[model samples]
Target: MSEGPGATAHRAVTVRGPLSDARASEQARGDHHAAPLAAASWLLTTAMDLHRMAGALAEGLTAESGDDAEAVARLTSRWTSLHRDGGPPAEHTRLEALVEIRRPRTRRPALLWQWSGADPVAALAASSGRLARELVAVSQAAPLAEAFVGPVVLAPETAVHFVHETLGHSLEADNYRDYAAGCGLVVGSTVAGPQLTVVDGPLPGLETSRPRDDEGHTSRSTPLVEAGVVAGVLTDAREARRQRLPRTGNGRRAFGAAEALPRMSALHVARGTTPHAELVRPVRHGLYCRGAWGGGSVEEFFVVRPACAEWIEDGELTGRFVYGFDVKGRKISGLGALGSVGDDMGVFNPVTGCGKYGQELPVSMRSPSLAFDRLCAVPIAPASPSPPP
Candidate 1:
């Protein structure tokens, strides 16, 4: 919260594009109608002068706010424009048209589509159209399934989210101490197997992505997991110094928050050669989590609310749907139980925000489908809201 030379700020708002999503996501959340979304005031965060703090940074902050905030405010009429029934148009869905500033612009402009096969920018328009249709179709396809336990194939979107909630959050430098003390997450220890790797960095040309951290540290990729080992943890200037670790450019803050802390920007779980279609090949009886309600992790325990899932029998989808299922497991056990990783790394702009310590931030994840062996899922109440993570 220091108003120093390295200070940085972010402007944000939540919106859903196209009229259909505004209506559908309402139902997706078990609401009868799409309620209006309102954005809060801009957040300005200050921390140690990253240049002075970290000698070899890639860039520095400037006094002039010559970036997307101005344009975004103008378009939203300082947010009065957000009153419109529909949100940002389809052509502007990828968000490249509205703003080019990556370091400080974070907006949940829309949650139209989720795709896993190609470049995010090029596929945004088509992906949203396709996914919006899928959301409706999947939800209406069938009734909920009975409680079950076995192998499970988490869709690309849900899989990345599982990693984000479990492993990614544990990698935050400040959160590392808490987990290490109680959850057995040792830095140099091999927790997840060699088949997986996770990273958090300034992934340019993606929505809700950041180039430099809030503390003015340049966008640098920090390895959270590499070839199955807990390679490194994320850190802002304060935590890095406090913990005697290197800064990872992961500092972030939200409006109405006390200060910037280490957080993720573009979280990526490396892909594998397994085809998306063949992910369920080994599952004799299990669930295929097509979409997720939301998930959370505390210490080592975690729970994922899969909004829509299909039963898999004899290595194929049974075509019957299951609704409102919770997949619960321990972090280390789940990672070690990873059965397969798909090549189709999904890119998504979900409406559900990532919340930490009561602050919510718009973020995105690119991950592939993941299959796990011996995952136990129980049925939950049918109609409920996704709890904040």
Candidate 2:
């Protein structure tokens, strides 16, 4: 791949963290026992000028490495400080301590992409007409303006929410395998109305672009639902064949060696007709949901946190609710309960990755602000993870 400005290069190695490779391999082979993790990291140049050199090194390694096992061992040794069976314990302790030593930094509006051109950012900047109007409405309607200030792009946020709630969590093949709730359970079931449709594609215009999945397959969009009916399950090649469905290019991985699984990319909710104003005004006692921070849902039971919600009273935009909602019941049930869908769709580029089966990768979601008749909500509380060791 050609390297551009602001680009850098690195060499990587994978190793077990707080665990041994033998233990990780055993666990992977289904002899599950408690183990920390098999982790990987890289040591590379930070200068943008080293991009070409980095690429060349990576290509050289792949071409010249004698074998997979030898390559992996060399990479692991170079990137990680191996502590065979027994170490001074000082090494492990120091590494554990180092994890929390770095001070948290303020987040900024930064761009992260590979081999990107100037056109995409330009498109996002130019497409802000509707977003600008929506943000004005949100800002004015917000109970407190000072609390909400940044590059407020509504369309992208809307797209993200839609994909997260409706697509990403919904299409997981594991959920389908377990006969779990939400989109998976109703795979072949028909929809009740025109309120549902989902498609995942790495379409050129969408932000979550992937030319080829880690599984070495050309990417393409996979339709999961259509016109509120249970159309199909998202599938990788394996699941596609097993379930007798077409491979939707959902195969993805954390890296080249990691096993692939069905994952969503550039999920898009089917187009709808409800105008932005119309979706908001009709909510007599509901919320205009926007931007989601993070969430976890199992079998359609989930709690969306740090989400921005505006209280709707009468037929007008109202004040902000500040807190988020805990959506209970079956996920598909809730989706089946969708009250209205909006016309504008957006994609979110969160500074986070999607983790499944211990692999993490960059992902994005797209959706529009939605309103429901009876969404569950609650107050925020203290977190459990240690602030910093």
Candidate 3:
């Protein structure tokens, strides 16, 4: 609850490649009866591109390390692309890659990554290369002994995760009630800044887009937070009736056999007019956080670990910093601390799956870079140093 000495501020950043809505439509209109050989050719081309990109990235890292065998221990990937017609149409393609950078004497951690979009091969290459660089930096840096507790910026990619965990989850009718079953969230509570608006619905061509819920309910855009106020919460028919709230068409099931529950589709934070530089320029000392490996929550309290982060001095990135701290805080409090939002919005191809009960649902998030004024980051002990050879 109290800021400690050595406490520094932090922010988050994520870069996603471009996806063409037009191309998605074109694909939808193209002949559905293409030859099997043509489909096979496309898959082969994508596979080769991924293979080349991974090899090149590993080679670059190895060259920098001055060891031929230290660049990569193993590289494995899985690819899935399918097109289906019937019951409102369904089409999807995905590539998941794991890259392990070899180190002397110690077993290095593997980077588990994924991509889905119009050009997944290109996305995979770019993401993989960026991750390799981060791993190298992580290996050479010293862990922070003290935690940072203050203002921070959440990069577009990081903001997506932050919003999803803190805002989106908190706005779920069931989840919110589970945590506040007796008191419940106030409908008009001030949850964030005036510039922060959150929405959940279908954005066709994007990864989370769906024409209907698993129960065959037509999808519609629902505003969860409007201009900093709690406009609404995602709910299914049962929860809506139980709570006397309106159904927002968010009821969804993981599969045909699973029961329906309230779930988010393409949840995103509306962008603002502020230039990204404006968000960081005023902060004399803070962090530029990037990437979300994964995180967990209990009630309204949550902890998220960034994949990589850098020190920000005088509003500019200064040096790469060890990322072993948990950005921990209460959900509402975190959103309330929003300082500014940027115009650079990113809609990531859904990679991480959201799970509740015994089912996993595919979800996507979009957000601009966001800044928060007083948050907490608790230092986590770094992974033990590798044993000497």
Model 1 residue 244 lDDT?
Answer: 98
- Residue-wise C-alpha lDDT for candidate 2, range 1-389, written one tens digit per residue: 11211111222222221111211111121111222222322211111112222222223322333211111111111111111112111011001100000001212111111211223224334433433333333333323222221112123354355346544666666556655433344666654357767777786555446665544566777667787665656677777777676766667654322356777766767657878778766656555555445566555565454335565667665655443233334465455556666787655543345667677655655566554544445544436887786
TM-score per candidate = 0.67, 0.59, 0.77
lDDT per residue for candidate 3 within 1-389, as digits (tens), equals 11211111111112211111101111211232332122434544454455455556555655555543232211112221222212432223233323334444445442445555556566666577556766565655555568888778877777888888876777788986787333334568777779989889887546767776654567788888889887888887778898898777787765332357888878978888889889888888887777667776567777777766677788787766667677878886787889898998866665546877766766777889998887777788767999999
Model 1: weakest 10-residue lDDT segment is 73-82
**Candidate 2: stretches off by over 4 Å:** 1-159, 181-184, 324-329, 384-389
Q: Looking at model 3, which ten-residue stretch has the lowest summed lDDT?
A: 17-26
Best by TM-score: 3
Model 3 stretches astray by more than 4 angstroms: 1-41, 65-105, 125-140, 180-185, 382-389
Q: What lDDT does the true structure give each of the candidates?
A: 0.57, 0.44, 0.63
Per-residue lDDT of model 1, residues 139-165, tens digit only: 344545566767888887678778888
Q: Between the candidate structures 1 and 3, which one is better when assessed by TM-score?
A: 3
lDDT of 2: 0.44
